[model samples]
Target: MRVTVSQPTRRGTRRSHGVRAPAPTVASMTRLLPVLATAAVLLAACTSDAETPASSGCDPALAAWADAGFSGAIAITAGGETVCEEGYGDANTALTVFAIGSVTKAFTAAAIYDLVDSGALVTSDRVGDLLPELRGPVRDATLMQLMTHTSGLNGSAGADHQPLWRADAIAAIGAMPLAFAPGTDHVYSNAAYTLLALVVEEVSDSTYREHAMTRILDGFASAGFWDGAPAAVGPRAVGHLDDGSTGEAGDFAGPHWALDGNGGLAMSMPDLAAWTHALFTGGVVSVESAAAIADPVVDLGDGAAETPGWVARDASAYGEPFLAAAGGGGDVGHDTMVVWIPSEERVVAVASNGGDVSAEELMAAVGPALAAGDPIPAPDAPGGTVDPDVAAAIVGDYRLDTGGAYRVSDDDGLRIAALGADAVEVLFPPRDAAAADAVRTHERAVADLLAGETPAGREELAALEDEFGPVGGAEPAGTIVADGELRTYATLATGDGPLLVWYALDDEGAVSAVEAGAQPPALDLVTDGDAFRPADPAGTGPDVTVSFAAGVLTVTGPDGAVTAQRD
Candidate 1:
């Protein structure tokens, strides 16, 4: 989902376009005796090695989600001590490693800063200067523009799992026209981070992995791009769909195109918490560079600003100051949300492996309360106890992920809506139809929509094929109940891109509404307004998966074919 300063993000449709998740990082610091006295004094403490953080409170929403089938880890650190760290559902609270999605950009930004610190790279240098082979509109985009996501790039040059080799990845990005002139506007472009990763390779004369591990990732024992790690590093969590079943084992061994620099690292929560602490406390980069990395260098307006690694907001936006960032692969179901309250020197983070419960949603439920030091409800407290007065008071307009305008509020959780109406779009509209026809029409509609036949944004959408690549046929991916509708999805493709198309049908076997993308984001629930719940239409449970009753399913793969039926 696209998020702004007014709300939590890195999920919704952006993530719904969902590909990968939030990220992790950490390290110790040696006191720096900078020439300036003030700088030296500040560095003396902020740059000291990390002390173990402390754990303090419990959150009722976390408990609610955990009981609701959310499986993930959370890490919170404050005053150089652990606050609360726990794993929920099937995950090991202390040992499960997760794919930390866009959170990885924090490190990419850090690596760039470290290079700057060492006089190896300059933020003002044009991206093209470092990688001459890059011939896209962003060629002249300064490194600063890239870090701030103002390089005129929009999302990806290809799918999150395309696996294009390095040369091809570079060529793909180089060939795409920038959405606008570099430094002219802002769009969270994952491809830009991949390009930055390439710069890391070119300037450092080493792999992004090698350089990051040695320089920026010095203290992260298990945080690195997903590849083999010693057994002690920890077991990686499998991504689960909103349904309790159908968890996926992630594949991070890669051609770093989709995975690099943007959102490709995996690590345990402790490592992730430590990384944020280290970076913010001056244990990672210099204080000045850390500030640049953590705070906005470019203003995106609407209470949002782009920093090297985060999306920052002043007190006016969130009712308090915070530096926020979130990421997750809609496809993998691995998600993370992080909020650093600079005033309290506290970091609150949530990571989830279940698609049904997004970290963004969970964080919204608890982060603000945790920050305010509000009374913590009992872990067993029912999800319905949020004060109605507070809920009403919280209602307001929001500009969320990708800058979508929203009428939003939170009581149970944040819901986006049209002012005073049920204009919220459904994730999967209701449907009842023959399987063959649904599949056929769904595929055609997707290609046609992305190919620019859709009326509203034809001109703007004309180049989608360049970013996600030309559309191809689709295949059944999964099924889940959404708002009580038996919604279904197909693993759609665009140059082997892992895109998704979800739809619902009417009683007469006609499609009601169909949505497709890497993530159209909260486009699913946002339209529901305050009436929406993280539950089914019956208001009893999440919109999750349901097995067919007395129905048959077919499976055909390279090995053979099989059929299953209700006994």
Candidate 2:
């Protein structure tokens, strides 16, 4: 059904990429968008005790996090009953309540659907038809597209210089060019929803935050959803930064801004689990939109090269690449996961203030590990030195600086980059060495895509990757090299074998690229950083350094480095 979504404006609203400033003092230093699918071993091995419908079970996955050094809260529900509710690490650095990010989107979408049910609006109506100020291609986009991210608006363009707040948000998105013809592709734009919040304000005749509090957040309190915003930091588990520091600098620390429709909602794990149950069960949107909302609307399979091995690998393992799902956006300092299993009549919410644990793998492991009635295995972290042959496979020239002119290359085991920084820093993490010894971050590029928990396009990419192979790793014997603009790369096999291939493109807002063990000539490339039409895309190798400490795996690349505990 079509609905009209209007964009609104706020007076004294300072905007930057749709986030209002006085940015909530949230201390978590999160990464972004690492989603999981079913094919991953984390799923196959974790779901051994698959209970029948209506059966409930304590998620053994809870204990798994402690093994992985995760600190936060978790809740599991079956048949609309609270099956498990428990807290792990601190909710805030002060040790108070849990802070929920972008889950606010689900609430916002629900509120919009409520308006539709009340005959106030329809999801199929054109956004521009509602608010004239929401001019340009956005006006041409429908409310459903905006809700589903099929509209080309981006929550945050990769521009670091863009100011972040309400006023700046409106101006930036309003002025930005459409990434694609509206409804032609899905980009997962938070700014689009922020604008939808504007629509909420326009129709409800109230502020976006006010409308949400009244229609959604308040519903939780009325429904026995406790664990409200903490007045003082309580005994919650604490999420720490890599440096082990807390307060404003750490992952879980302080309050930033209030929850709006687009983001900024905070609550305990049980509360969110309850809220999600209500949502999927028709407490908010109609069952029709509810089902449609969860259904896959766009394909994001090509974005895997930018995903970390932990996340990209999981998506390939869990749900089918064709299954539709949503709601997995996460920040670096902030780590949270909620998986609603319709067939099982279950909803599992896993949260943590900590950084760099494989939530998907943990879930996959827990489902089977618990089902097998297997005693929680002694914590055996994932670790194994890569064969020099495998290590030699990924070693080559890779582009480190995204927008820089100079190039970087790696020899045997050492990496040097002209990144044109103050000095030519050697970018590699040390194995069994001091943390300060590494030059560049070990897990940057790999972690960048996995930083957030957005689950929208994971299944699709996981399927494609499964058909291909790992983004990096040796096949038989070969050398990898950048072909043209460093947007694509090739791996030439030593014997009479085909060349491995990969490429990336910026469509709408998300990045898309495909890779295969065998190279394809008609690959697409991004030139001038804007247009990624079609060119022989190529890339220099990203210098990779791997280190293991205390059973943890640390990897460094161009963007940054993250260590995953092998629990």
Residue 459 shift from truth in candidate 1, angstroms: 13
lDDT of 1 by residue, 1-567 (tens): 221112211122223221211110000000000001111112122223432223323333456667654578877677657766778877756558887777788889899998888799989999988997877677898888888878886555555554668888888888766667887766557778888888998999688878878888787786776542321167878786433333335553556566678867778877887888788878888888887787667765555567887777655534555675666644455777666767657675667776444554443343333444453222222234444664465355533232323343463454433211111222222233343344344445543444456431253243334555665645554333332233444554678476655544322122332345522223223222223333321122333221111233222222233233322
Model 1 worst lDDT window (10 residues): 24-33
Clashes of each: 49, 97
Model 2: lDDT equals 0.41
Q: Which candidate wins on lDDT?
A: 1
> C-alpha displacement of 142 in model 1, angstroms?
0.9
lDDT of 2 by residue, 1-567 (tens): 000011211111111211111111111101122233321222223333553212223444445555544456656666677665655444422223444445556667777876787788898888777666655567788887777676777544222112245544556557656767887865545666666776787788666666666666565642211123322122333434222333122122222222234544555566666777777777766787566556544443432211100111113434432111222222223445555556445665665665333333344334444434565443334333335654344333333232211121123222222221211222221222322221122222212332322332243234434544333332221111111011222342324244343322222213332233422222111122211111110111234444434444344455466444433
